[model samples]
Target: MNQEIQEYNESQTTDIKDVCNRLAQIIDGNLPEAESKIWHRHPVWFLDGNPTVGYSIQKPGVRLMFWSGADFEENGLNVVGKKFKDASIFFQHVSEIHQEDLVRWLNKSKIIQWDYKNIVKRKGELVRLKKS
Candidate 1:
């Protein structure tokens, strides 16, 4: 794990900390080539400079978000963003995380991506970078 991300995970309250740690571990294990760091005050993983996946503590729980998850075609990530391709799921406990689903989503995240790295350059227009 990135030192900054580790510190961020460690800063959370106990239950949330476990969620963060598990999320980080799984994301790192699956996306070993992705660069991870604190982005916008949360831990995000970027693939070739494009944001892929991330997690943050929220009022509801620990939010695990995928930048282009709206098209992941998975039902578990129900909180789809209205303004972007982002989608997320909230986890109140570590046990709530289904490893199989998480792994499947992580795999989908690699093949399905949007051009978030240059969204500003395109005036917020998102173009597909890959497809399932």
Candidate 2:
């Protein structure tokens, strides 16, 4: 872990960090033996140099950004955050993350890594097609 991740992880409230850590562990568990790296100023889990997932700190929150969030059709994982118009899921607080949902999203991302164009299109479509 980088200093930033360590600092951010430590700075989190026990409840918040607990959730964040759990999320990380879930991602790691699912992608066992994969190499995880710290990049984009955050903790990023990768496989064979391809980004599988990313995480970052936010005001009063943390975000679990998936590389293929747009390809996720179930559980509304694509619309989990205000900035997710790209390909990320932001958890405003630890309480907002459902373990099952996060795991599903991670698995979804892993499965859809090669469908980048479709993923981007879906993300854009969701933002433009959905009504607030």
Candidate 3:
């Protein structure tokens, strides 16, 4: 277990911590011995050396980010960055966490390969194509 994540969870309120714990558990349970790491001070779940999901304690609450969020059919998640395919979902309370949806997201996200720089380059190419 990463001490950074433990410390991060410990610093949060009970509700916020619960949401974090549940998200961690969901990812761990779904994946085959998932590897956990602290990236950018946030707890990240990885699959085959690729980042699948991550969670952090933001002022608004626990912010959950998924790497393959753009692959989803509906754009319900807030776009995390224009340069990457990641998306974010905010949870202020444990009760607000939708376990089923999260499970689905993690399951789907684990298989997608995300290359942030390449994605950004490709996006820029598409923009250039459109202007021309």
Candidate 4:
């Protein structure tokens, strides 16, 4: 994990901390090629500079978000973003994280991606960079 991301995980309360640590470990293990850092004040992993997966401490809980997950077609990633191609699921406890599901989502994240890296250049329009 990145230094700042480590601190971010450490800064969370106990339950949330466990969830963050577990999430970080799983993401690192699965997406070894992805770059991880604290983006928008949360831990986010990127593939080829495009944001892929990330998590943040939200009022609801720890939100695991996939930038292109709206098209992943998986029912578990049900919290879809209205303005972007993002999708998410909340986890208040580390136990809620199913390794198989997480790995599956991570795999899908690699194959399904939105061009958030150039959203500024495209003037808020999103383009698909990968597909299932």
Candidate 5:
């Protein structure tokens, strides 16, 4: 566990922390290669040194974002921001988490490489490569 992650988790509300915890468990248990770290103030799960998924505490709720999520199935993803091929799903309560749906995405996420820089510079490059 990361110190930053520990601090962030401790500072959040119980519901928010619970959502974070569940997602962390899903990623950690399913993806042995993925490492949890604090990136841009959020807890991010990295695979092959690239950010695959991350969660942040926002004003509306806890936002779970996938770095190359634009390529992921529409099962539970919501396209977010016009800049990059990023997608997100928001959970207002802990009970809203669908473990199966999230785990499916997590499995798919590891196969895609997220170049945080190129994602902003050349949108969809990662997803395009993943599809090819």
Candidate 6:
């Protein structure tokens, strides 16, 4: 993670760390060997260095962004922000997190990452990754 990104993330609410940690647990628990790092001022999960998931803390809620979520058939996942159009989902609370749905989405994201590594590799490029 770059110092500027870290500083920007740190500038958010105190729950930022907690949200990051919890989201990391969720990703790690469901997707074994998933790589994680700070990207675009948020915690990002990757497969083979390609981003699959991302998260950040906001004032009233946490946001989880899934890069390939919209491609899935299910619609139970929450959506927010203008960024939602490009295969992403957002969650305000952990309680709103559906493990099965998330796992499905994460699996799909993993495939997306594997399918087109270079196109989806950049940070803040708006490639889908879950945000919380």
User: Best candidate, lDDT-wise?
Assistant: 1
Model 4 has an lDDT value of 0.92
lDDT of 5 by residue, 36-84 (tens): 8898778997775678788998888998998888877575799966767
Model 1, C-alpha of 105: deviation from truth (Å)? 0.4
State each model's CA lDDT, in order: 0.94, 0.63, 0.71, 0.92, 0.78, 0.60
Put down candidate 4 lDDT per residue, 1-132, tens digits, no spaces.
Answer: 889889999999999999999999999999999999998888999999999999999999999999899988989987545889888999999999999999999998989888999999999999888555
Sort by lDDT, top down from the best: 1, 4, 5, 3, 2, 6
lDDT of 3 at 94: 81
TM-score for each of the candidates = 0.96, 0.66, 0.77, 0.95, 0.83, 0.61
lDDT of 6 by residue, 1-132 (tens): 434445555565555555554556668777787766677757776776656677766655777776555555557645454544335555555566667777777776665532324554554354444433
| Ranking of candidates on TM-score, top first | 1, 4, 5, 3, 2, 6
RMSD to true structure for each model, in Å: 1.2, 7.2, 5.9, 1.3, 2.8, 6.5
Q: How many angstroms is residue 59 displaced in model 5 relative to the true structure, after the best TM-score fit?
A: 1.5
Residues forming the 10-long window of minimal summed lDDT in candidate 5: 123-132
Question: Can you write out model 1's per-residue Cα lDDT over 1-132, one digit (the tens) per residue?
Answer: 999999999999999999999999999999999999999999999999999999988899999999999998888997546779999999999999999999999999999999999999999899999555
Worst 10 residues of 2 by lDDT: 123-132
Off by over 4 Å in 1: none
Deviation from native of the Cα of residue 103 in model 4, angstroms:
0.2
Worst 10 residues of 3 by lDDT: 123-132
Local distance difference test, candidate 3: 0.71
Of candidates 6 and 1, the better by TM-score: 1
Candidate 4 stretches greater than 4 Å from native: none
The best candidate in terms of TM-score? 1
Instruction: Indicate whether candidate 3 or candidate 4 has the larger TM-score.
Output: 4
RMSD of 5: 2.8
lDDT of 3 by residue, 1-132 (tens): 467777777777889888887777777777756788788788987765557788888788888888767655445578756665778889988888777887777766755546542445566432211111
